[model samples]
Target: MGARAALRHGAARIERWLEIEREQLVLWLPVMLGAGITAWFVLPDAARWIGFVLGSLALALAAMVLPGGGRAPRALAIAGLALAAGCALIWWRAERVAAPVLARPALAVFAGRVERVEQLPARDMVRVTLSPIGHADLPPRVRVNLARADAPAGLTRGAVIKLRARLMPPPAAAVPGAYDFARVAWFSRLGATGKGFAPVEVVMPGVAPGADLRARLSGHIQSRIAGSGGGIASALATGDQGAITEEDSEAIRRSGLAHLLSVSGLHVTAVTAAAMLLVLRLLALSPTLALRWRLPLAAAGAGALAAVGYTLLTGAEVPTIRSCVAALLVLLALSLGREAITLRLVAAGAFIVLLLWPESLAGPSFQLSFAAVTAIVALHESPRVRGWFRRREEGRGRRLLRGLGSLLLTGIAVELALMPIGLFHFHKAGIYGALANIVAIPLTTFVIMPLEALALALDMVGIGAPVWWLTARALDLLLWLAHITASAPGAVAALPAMPGGAYALIVAGGLWVALWRTRVRWGGLAPFAVGLGWALVTPAPDLLVTGDGRHLAIRTADGAMALLRDRAGDYTRSMLGENSGAEEELALLSEAPDARCSPDLCLVEVRSGARRWRVLATRSGYMVPWAEMIALCKATDVVVSDRRLPPGCIPRWLRLDRDTLAKTGGVAITFADARIRAVRGGGSHPWLTPLTVQPPFAARPEGGGRATR
Candidate 1:
């Protein structure tokens, strides 16, 4: 009798809790849909069809149960249906975007029509996207970088050109859990990338009105502003960021002002709001029109038109399209006298974006943009925040102070929300991003963008020089602020790659806290805290190896990373540094006193607690004798080489040569308690060649083999 009473009490509490939260249920639709999309992306290719079949069955079951089920069962059924629909939608989208990918690297002469041309002023190169002509063997589209001197004259979009170039398949991740460029290229229909070796020959000159206008505007902007500031102005006006210097770009990113360069929600809102206000004021000047006409509706229509025109003029990037959708929604709400900004508006925007571009869910832009908006909306919607705004009126000075304080608080909330995403994708988060944004946001929104627009308008009548000068000055100040903030001590908090489980925990907890209105929302902080702690406590790998086996890094006893090659390229070094969580630059292993080196190979001994391990890596292309290699492999615990090892040349612990690296992509190794643990890279995805099953490499324990897969 006592057990039955306790069970009944627990059930009642759960039922009441569900009843209290029923109104907020609609907010979870996108979350359920996104879950299915994520599962599709992460699942193996062979299992996708099976999973889809199962999802369809589940959807049918849910539909049958939803009509007559209890509250809990009905909620579960709705979630199930959304999840299954998401899976089906993404599966269809992937098939729709499928195109031929380059199978291997080759040097060939080909003719193609230019689709787009991007200038890289910093590198003195111009990258052009082309649609292959008369070559069924090649990919539908390819991108090639040509030196300024090698590129032909009148190289613009729609021009037919011929070139001899070396083309390679889209690049994969450099290290495990790092960025995957191939996945991005796959969705974009770009199958290969290459560099032009010979001068491009122009067969015909073609005209493109959009490309020509953009180029002319960019050239004009650069002529008006003297330095890198002009590049920023051009980016704002035409979305051409190719003119920005690399150093300035880095500074802006590190300082957390990078959003200013992207034409996202902030820019869209500014343009739309400006247009609406202008239209409203002009209509108000005529009292007859104001009294007789639907002024707000007319203003909203004008704003919508402006938003659409701006989005198209700026190349209709994914972020721009998303902002446009949201802006249009806001206009619709205003015209109908409904609340303009709400969580529902954001959810609708996300649903539309996902419906159109499901693959974008995997990108940083979509994640960061949506996360920031959701956080801001959740914050402002809180009862306490609303109460504070309803306080008695105050003096002008006090009102100004309150407004600034609100801006700062909003900035802090957005930073906290974006931290997990930043760490997951970049392995680092800006420490002072909230503080930097407080100043940067207003300056860009009020001073720089408005002045830029005004100057462009004046340029049509040939009196824009003065306003253009002011725009340049303001941009210079913005750049200066970015540099100062980025140079500050401890501006970035770097972490090693976070585990997927921890990342998921943080995201789930954040959504729970943002979506719920009851005190139960506090429970989400528990998982959020645990996820952060887990990421901070996890140990980084002891050794790193690139996919090509040409570069290697090991953490030394002094707690510094040492590299096998000192002359590695900047990109390779940066990637190694990020993955290893090294705060300082990597030093050459050859400079270490404990390392021994020959012309072809270098050997280093690393100690972890009481266990000592030996690592031998190739230093040059020169091949060592087979007998010497066999002897060396026996001596070292691990052997890493760009070339394939000879037969019977296995090491006591592990061997990572060309054949293994080709399959694994990259390898991260850890040593502890007389055991060697290795984590290999590459995944079963369409963009990547499927990895074949292989026999486990055996590591000898006490002269007997222990297998590792």
Candidate 2:
């Protein structure tokens, strides 16, 4: 009787909790859907279908039995349905977008029409997106890179071009959960990527109609303006970052201006506000209409149209689409003279975006964008927060101080909201973001954005020079400010990589705090506190082995990652976002006490507890003493070699070489308790483009070499 009573008591508490959560089903439904989308990234490829099936079955069963009695039952039913729908949605979208796999890397000559051209100023490479080649099995688009040395004179959209190209499957993630280039490529409808050699022949000169027109116009805008300033102007005007310099990009990131560079909320808000005002003023200028109907409804229509225009002009990327949807929702509320941009609208907009692109749950852009806006909206609506800042002082001096204080507080709130996300995704925070925002936000929101919009309009009449000049100047000032701020000591702080589930817990806590309708919402704090502890406690990886490649990196006792000078390291470094100058600080091949090397081979010793492990990394083409090779292979803990080792030379040695890489691609490994565990770049999903391969005589998987890069 005691045990049964205790069980009933526990169940009662759960029912009570559900009853409370059911009141906020509006928020809960979307949050659950978002979780389903996230499960796509977390669950392995094979297990994804299981989630979809189980989730769907749960919802189906709940729907059959009307959940009308207890609030807990209703809430549970709703949650189950949402989760099932979310999982099903992932597969629905994935299957719809799935296309052919390249299977392996290959070089071939091809012909296709140029759909788009991207000039990468930093890499000095021209990227060309082409229509599907001769093969019907290939994807609809193929992207090729032209080395600066071999770049053609130019490329025009709609122009049919032919060139010798090396084609291969899109890259897998550099590390598990790092980033999935393969999935990105699949969604982009691009099956292959490779370098092109020789001149691009224009069989037919033309450009695709419709949306490419906007892209073409952007290019023309760049052509009309001159120099790097033109690049920045074009980028700001039409969501293109290809021309932006890498150095400037870094500075922009450090100064908190990077988000502004992306085509999203800031740009959309400025455009919508301007459009609404312009329409209202134009309508007011007409005496009859002004007297008859001065309601915001008509202006709301104009704002929606303007937002749509901007979305189209910017290629309708996921971020742009999300912003536009939210903007339109706000405009819809304005038509009814209701409060715009309320939590209800946010929740509705989020649900709509999830339906449109369930895969976005895995992208940092989606997470950061939504998280920032959600925090801003919640804070702005908080009665207590608003009450504290309500002051009536009217002097110019007092007004200036109040305005600055408001902006500063806003900056602090946004940064606080984004801290967990920033650390988890990019692994860095701008120490000077607040200071930088004080100087930069107003300039960007008020001056730069306005001028860019005006410039686009002026360009149609060939009189945009004045606006373009002003816009360029504003951008130049922004760039200057970014450089100054980034150069300051401690302007950027590096964060250690978060442990598994740390980010998810943070997300859950944030959602609970933001979504709960009542005071019990404070309960979310427990999960948040636990998550923070985990993030801070998770240890940085001590060993990094190239997944299928020969390159190896090790975190030294002092906390710096050292790469062997002879190995390919730069490519992996880019993905990892090593703190500034990590490469410069990396120990050379000859620096380790127990490691020594010649051109063909190097042997190093590693320790875990009281035991030592030997590792051999070698390139085989060059001559090497065989007797020493035998010694190195004796019970070697790991071997990544290009050469064929003597058969059973050392029975205990673990070999990871060209053949292993050919079959499995690359993997990273960690060492512990008398064993080595390897992690592939990431699991290959059904959605990935299949790749085919032809290995050469000396096929070495490059950790950061040509293969991985």
- Which of the numbered candidates is closest to the native, going by highest lDDT? 1
On residues 404-500, what C-alpha lDDT tens digit does candidate 2 reach at each position?
A: 8877877777777677787777767677787788888899889887887788788888898888778888878988999998888887766555655
TM-scores across all candidates? 0.93, 0.88
Candidates' C-alpha lDDT:
0.82, 0.70
| Candidate 2 residue 62 C-alpha distance from true site, Å | 5.5
Error of 1 at 579 (Å): 1.2
Q: After superposition, how far is residue 562 of candidate 1 from its true place, in Å?
A: 2.2
TM-score top scorer:
1
Those runs of model 1 whose alpha carbons end farther than 4 Å from true positions after fitting are 1-12, 52-68, 208-211, 673-683, 690-709
